[model samples]
Every structure is written in structure tokens, then in C-alpha cells.
Target: MNRLIVTGASSGIGLAIARRFRRDDWSVINISRRPCPEPGVTNIPCDLAQPGAADGLADALSPWLLDRPRLCLVHNASIMQSNRVDTLGSADLRATLELNLVAPNAINRIVIPHLPPGSSILYIGSTLAEKAVPGVAGYVIAKHGLVGMMRATCQDLAGRGIHTCMICPGFTDTEQLRNLIGDNAGTLAAITGLSAFDRLIAPEEIADAVAFAAAAPVLNGALIHANLGQRER
Candidate 1:
């Protein structure tokens, strides 16, 4: 049976990805702080921001890891904090890495070995994964590290038949984006204006990109930007 093991499917792009996979009849397992609202998705409650959280999930995940003909593991959970490089504290940075970086590594150790041929490991990155934006120093740092992780995974898993890549989404329309732009038309406009499309990308679009990446082994080690073209300043 084909399966999709994804992190942070409770909402936003993560939720969309889970639903997309489910539509294709793949068994979906979500690991996140809250359950995915979608029917037929199996949720494993986890607070990924807490250090060592994924380590304790081995037993809970063992059943799903067994004998699957195809598997797709997506590292999608992430945190973005508003802080400048000068103002970013080590503790604050560590907290971000715990979720955005370390948790994925921990889960990879547990899941990668069990993956059968025709499996894929995908990382949900941001435009910030490659470029720096002000007031989100921690997020930028963690995302850049995620790119490196994806590249390393491709190299280390060579000849294993498991492809890996990072998909970077630009200015996506999600609940989180709406909350950040609350009651501010200018903020929304400014964000949309950055995109050549002059609109935020639908979560489903990014989900579609991920679904494609899962089946395209030729894209291994590629850093794909699913964000509609962004106009440079």
C-alpha cells in the first residue's frame, strides 16, 4: 500500500498536502500538535517545537512504517518568528531549530531506514530558504539549513531508490498568512505585489507540486520553487 507520512498537517499548506494525497487513495498519517481536520487521516499528536519529541514517537510510527510499497515522508512543520539578527537570542533560535530542523532529522532517522524502494523524502521550504527577509532571522536560518539537509539526504541515500528534494513556496495564501495580515489591506497588497501574478498562491498549488515531486526521481537534489514568479525590487 502507498502511504504519506507528513508533519504539521493540522492546517495550512500541510493540511492541503495531506488532503491531496488522500484524494489519490494513499493512507495519510499526520504528526502535529493538533489533528488534521480531514476525515480518513491518521493523526499522531506531537509538539515538534519541543526537543526530542520525535524520538519518543518510534513505537507509534512503527506500525505505519512496515512493508509499504511506496512511502512519501514530508517534513513540513515550521515556525517563523519576528526578530532581527541582532535581536535574535540563542534560546529563541534553538527553539526554532528544534522544530524546523532537529525534529525532522529525528523523524528521518526513524522512517528512512524502513522506507521501501520508490519512496521520497520531501522538505517544505520557503522563499526564505534561499533568500533573507527582514524581521524573520530565525526562520531564514533554519530554512537555509533545511536546504542543506535535503541536499545531504540525496547524497547519502544514493542508489537507495529514495529520491529527495526541497520545495520552496512563495507568498502562499493560508490561515497563517491571513492572521499575519489582519485588518491591513496595505500589508496584503504589498505581499501580493511581490508576486508577478499579483496574488497569493493557493495552498493546493503547492500541494500539487509536492505530489509531482514525490513521483519524479529525476528531480532528486533539486530545489524547486513553486512560488509564482516574484518581482525583484
Candidate 2:
């Protein structure tokens, strides 16, 4: 049976991805603090921001890992902090890495070995993974590290038949983005204006790209930007 093991499917893009996979009849296991609202998604209940959280998940995840004909492991959880590079504290950065970087590594160790030949590992990155905007220093740093990690996954696992890649989404329409924009109409407009499409990307669009990447081994090691074209300043 095909399975999807995803992190942070409690909401936003993560939830959309889970739903999409479920629609295709893949069993889903979500590791996050809250349960995915979608029916039939098994929630593992993890707070990824806490260090060492993934370390204990091996036993809990073993049942799903065994004997699956195909698996898609998605590292999708992340936190965005509003702090400039000069003002970003080490503690804050460390916390972000604990969730955004370190946790994925720990989970990879647990799941990668058990993956079947047709399996894939996908990272949900951001435009910030390639370029930076002001005030989200911690997220940018972690995402940049994630890109490097995805590239290394391709190299280290060469000839394993386990493909890997990073999917970078632009200013997507999600609860996270809404919270970032708050009640500022101008900020929302400015963000949309930066998108060549003049609108925020739907979460399902990114999810669709992930679904495609899972099946396309030809895209291994690629950094795919699903963001609608962004107008450069």
C-alpha cells in the first residue's frame, strides 16, 4: 500500500497536502501537535519545536513504515519569526532550527531506511529558502539550511532509488500568511502585488506540485519553485 508520512498536517499547506494524498487513497500519518482535521489521517501528536521530539517517534512510526510498496515522506512543518538578522537571537534561531531543520533530520533517520524503492522524500521550502526578505531571519536561515539538506539527501542517497527534492512556495495563501499580514490591508496588497499573478497562491497549488514531485523521480535533487512568478524590485 502507498503511504504518506507528513509533518505538520494540522493546518495550511500541510493539511492541503494531506488531503490531496488522501483523495488518491494513500494512508496518511501526520506528526504534529494537533490532529489534522481531515478524516482518516492518523495523528502522531508531536511538538516539533521541542528538541529531540523526533527521536522518540521511531517506535510509533514503525508500523506505518514496514512493508509499504511506496512512501512519500514530507518535511513540511516550519515557523516564521519576525526579527531582523541583526536582532535575531540565537535562542530564537535555535528554536526555529529545532523544528525546521533538526527535527526533519531526526525523522529522516527513522523513516529513510525503511522506504521502498519507489519512495520519495520532499521538503516544503519557501521563496526565502533561495532569497531573503526583511524581518523573517530565523525562517530564512532554517529554510536555506533545508535546501542544503535536500541537496545532500540526493547525493548521499544516490543509487538508492529513493528520490528527494525541495518544493519552494511563494507567498501562499495560508493561515500563517494571514497572521503575518494581520489587519494591514496595504501589507496584503503589497504582498499580492509582488506576485506577477497579483494574487496569493492557493495552498492546493503547492500541494499539487508536491504530489507531482512524489511520482517524478526525474526531478530528484531539483529545487522547484511553485510560486507564481514574482516581480523583482
What's the CA RMSD of model 1 in angstroms?
0.7
lDDT of the candidates, in the order given:
0.95, 0.94
Global Cα RMSD, each model: 0.7, 0.6
Q: What is the lDDT of residue 80 in candidate 1?
A: 79
Task: State in Å the error of residue 199, model 1.
Answer: 0.2
Model 1 misplaced regions, further than 4 Å: none
When summed lDDT is taken over every stretch of 10 residues in candidate 1, the lowest stretch is 174-183
In model 1, what are the clashing residue pairs, if there are any? none
What tens-digit string does per-residue lDDT give for candidate 1 at 119-168? 99999999999999889999999999999999999999999999999999
- Cα lDDT tens digits for candidate 2, 32-90: 99999999999999999999989999999999987767999999999886998999888
